[model samples]
Target: MTAYLPMDREERREMLASVGVDLDHLFDSIQESQKLKKTDFSGLQQEGISELEVVERLTALADLNKRTDDYDSYLGAGFYDHYQPAAVNHLISRTEFLTAYTPYQAEISQGTLQAIFEWQSYISRLSGMDVSNASLYDGASAAAEAALMACREKRLYKVFVSAGMHPEYIETIETYCHAAGVEVEVGALNEAGKTAEFPTEKGYAAYMVQSPNFYGVVEDLPLLVEKAHATGALAGASCDLISLALLQRPGDLGVDIVTGEAQALGIPMSFGGPGVGYMAVTQKLLRKMPGRIAGETVDRDGKTSYVLTIQAREQHIRRERATSNICTAQALMATSATIWLALMGSSGIRDVAEQSAAKALYLQEKLLATGLFENTYDSPVFREFALTAKGSLDLYKLNQDLLAEKIFGGLVVDDNRWLLAVTEKKSKQAMDKFVETVVRLAQAQ
Candidate 1:
């Protein structure tokens, strides 16, 4: 007796018949005995809780939890809240954009292909790389997949990853390569927050590192890339796309592959994902890249047309030799990014990046001004940094107090330090509020 959309026995039977299947086929992929075993549990039915009752119950539960209006978020190890233009969302959410799938049919999907082509061009220019794919699942997958591309050659038994690379991404790569039986080596960070180790003696496939890495410190690219290349290993960089507006481009830094999250551009941080990952590589490495790629050409009418180019990805070629198992791309999100960049243009994007950098510095200065916190790393960063507070205050408790002030504090880096993220969304007033709240909490302690 399910309260929601309960189907009568006859209706259920008709549903199964309409699908041209029986109950067994519905559970065909799973072991049949495991299909809602009758003896496993008790089924209880209350005569459907009233809508009002449900709302009141939820409200009561919420009331037990504290509410805060002063939320100043410092929780950006990766995703930051950047101001998205209204037009970006409005254009990307149209039914045609939202509901579309991969444009495998060139004749019917010119518009979608054009949008992807624009996205590719924008990403290529931004990364200072040659070609760009339509999009990947997210940054972590793109990083791991890029590693595979870099390390897939014979005689390359090992890959080196930077310690500053986001831990989750490292885990993802390890998981993917472990199944493939490839060994992974981790490079330790130097005191200046850059990758310092190089496996020059041992032959390897690639070195994977992140710029403005997990600790929010920028790593030395040219020297690190040179080191990897000196060992005959490909250099792959994972970076925050927004930061690229002001930082040295990956191509200029001699990176062979660049992959990173595009969520910061205009996509809202939907709590870890539903965002797009962008992967760009030098023309030399394009054949090894994964995901769908759009290319420009002329149609039969001699008018401009766009089609899925570099047909070596999972969706376009033989399953075994395909560069990836990914069949679906983040079509709508890529469109969002295209719209975002088109609206912002080059100068606007740079302005946003500059403002974010300035805001982060302002917050750092204010936090240091309190004389109650210290920087954990000494390096140039884009928008986030670590702040170590005096005394062993419980970060969870401090967070609770800050929430009461409606301020979201930074991530808890450790027992004594917290990682705070400042973006263009944060203003001087917001920084002041956070600083004041932290100072008050410190004084009380």
Candidate 2:
């Protein structure tokens, strides 16, 4: 058998000797009281199994998971259930793209750099912004980072976020702001499902709102932006990228920073993870944007090339001076989103957005027809909406009943209100079955 460490006894001895101590001698300085004679990993150590046996065990464990493919799912809060094109996986899985790391050296990393550049361009065009960073961790972090950027750019310590934003995103912003010594204030949502009140004082750095927010209601962004501007604060929004296809661009509404989860683009809802977060800003805020930005240039040989430009991450510069402390970009995931956008083009994306909206409306109509559920808010919505079950039919019980029918129901947002989402991937027959199941559950109650 090959030695895992790649060192023979003699070589190991020589290395330890050069370090001026043997393994035991190296640990001689440790206090006897703090040292352990034997490592006790109780209950965690398992008996060794053969390779085939291990595979079988893992397969058995994996089979316990309720996969989306086998069940009807309406679960979309941030992560979605869009159909990823086969070509997206095929192209992204290529060795050159999949295994590529940060493209620090432009000469040897042209392919990766170009891919990132394209990703940035796609996001910029979709967002109607002057520029976009390579990518961030996820929607929550991107929103948090955007708040920080706003604070830095406007030179203010206070930020105002709408109560309509995703709860998780709000919590994340609070954590990031607390650490940065910035103040975060959440404004209330009005009857029209829009952020209503704003501080009359002119000390806020930015006003952040989410359209098709956690409740899936489209906020009045134009009016919101105007209010922010009146207070001399930048308007930032955490948006749903797919919804942007059918709605007015935040940039066109006078927003300074647009950040959103790109999961609905082409990425899967792989158990709520590995989704790319995109951040785009007006030209003036480009330098303060977080993460890597790829730029097109000419090589010494006069050939077009791509390179990392405007990297404001802490690793590349002084920590205090860095615009953001995000260590890396979501290169692979961003590439997936880029490929999805390229494949879909503008028309395809619009078609998807339209289909999702139509389906959601259809579901809403179907549920309301049965008199089992009613709309919680009367506002323009895109692919998702909130509904309240009539009578004593609890959302948790309904979800459990749905599980029995091999269907996953909408997420429970409030006490009897459920947030349901519809994607283009859901078929008419499937939606009908889901509606039938809900109707039956309602009747049972």
Candidate 3:
């Protein structure tokens, strides 16, 4: 607040005069509609507030938010509501793992580097790629970095993306492309919610698609990869990590690069993010990959050790020649994911995948059986699906009513379409209650 500024009255007047204005007109250049007023500060302008007052105010504000513990949520577009194992926190929270976020010093940070190496190994195996980076910021930023990598590798300024991909991802890619003077052409999706066959054009560096796309429709990865190769372009995909337990790995399908959200693995949604983004690439694209990479080698004693192997970001390499600007990895979230994958193994991931898909299918069936909703797309899904309300429904108001009962509902994709997600966390009773709430709201409306 201005009241607590260290500047005295004379200093303030002089500073105001230097800008050719008095105190009352200091913000005169600002538009009247957007100018800040003293009244906006509420209670901390003229009189200084104590630490206790600040705490009380912040506490009151915090009470206005809806906590996940109090709400049964079904909203997973990218970030999921999957249950995190208790051991994940207990392990990642250890002092050695918790504080060693960035592994710049290889000698002192072997433990951190090794953790990241394990994370990369898990990502590579899960994605079926030959190599993987330490990690990235989140799914959206990782997708952007993938596009950049493709364009740089092929020396082409244009790339093709699927319209079926998440809109947020598309926007992020566009931002990265715009800054780099690259062009992004969005391919169309068929009526069944799958990305259409690639175009016959030849000068693109890569083609990107999201499997189990925004509509939760699985795209034809092999077909798309073949088409991309036919056009002399690399194939890239954004996917869900857990879905790979049951689906074909992208590397086996000829995809050159795989990037996706790993939030479902162990990280909580935390009201949308800070999510862990995993990126894997074939052996050919290892150098082109952005972010850090941890590698294993023997020390002087001939014991196993980990070190920072590759860092191709602006901070490490020549700025103009650097692959990306991102330097540090999301250490805490990545550690959680690595621990979760280690504990889950193959069978645990498969079970989570199966149960999530089963629960999602059951939820969809219940909604459609109510006669108030219909299928939006004719496609198979992993853990999320969409439905079209058959009647006029105020989805916003409907969610409010659900919240009143400590329930958080589906995402409104558009006007009448609802995107519903289910994870291993959702039980039959919870989904039944969601269906009942929707019916009750529809009838009330």
| Residue 181 accuracy (lDDT) in model 1 | 73
List per-candidate RMSD values in Å: 3.7, 3.1, 5.7
Model 3 misplaced stretches (Cα beyond 4 Å): 1-57, 312-317
Query: How should the candidates be ordered by lDDT, best one leading?
Result: 2, 3, 1
lDDT of each: 0.82, 0.88, 0.87
Q: What's the TM for model 2?
A: 0.92
Q: For residues 1-445, what per-residue lDDT tens digits would candidate 2 score against the true structure?
A: 3335677778878899997868667778999988898867777746768979989989999999897888899988887899999999999998888888787878899999999999998888888899998899999999999999999998999999999999999999999999999999998888767787878789999999998898889988887789889999999999888888989888887889999899898798878889989999999998888888899999889999998776633455667666777868899999999999999999999999999999999998888888887888888888998888788888898899999899989998767988899999988998898998888886786
- lDDT (10s digit) by residue, model 1, range 326-368: 6667889889988999989999999989998989888888888
Which of the two candidates, 1 or 3, achieves a greater TM-score against the reference? 1
- Give the C-alpha lDDT of model 2: 0.88
TM-score of 3: 0.88
TM-score of each: 0.90, 0.92, 0.88
What tens-digit string does per-residue lDDT give for candidate 3 at 231-291? 9999999989899999999988899999988888878777788888889999999888988
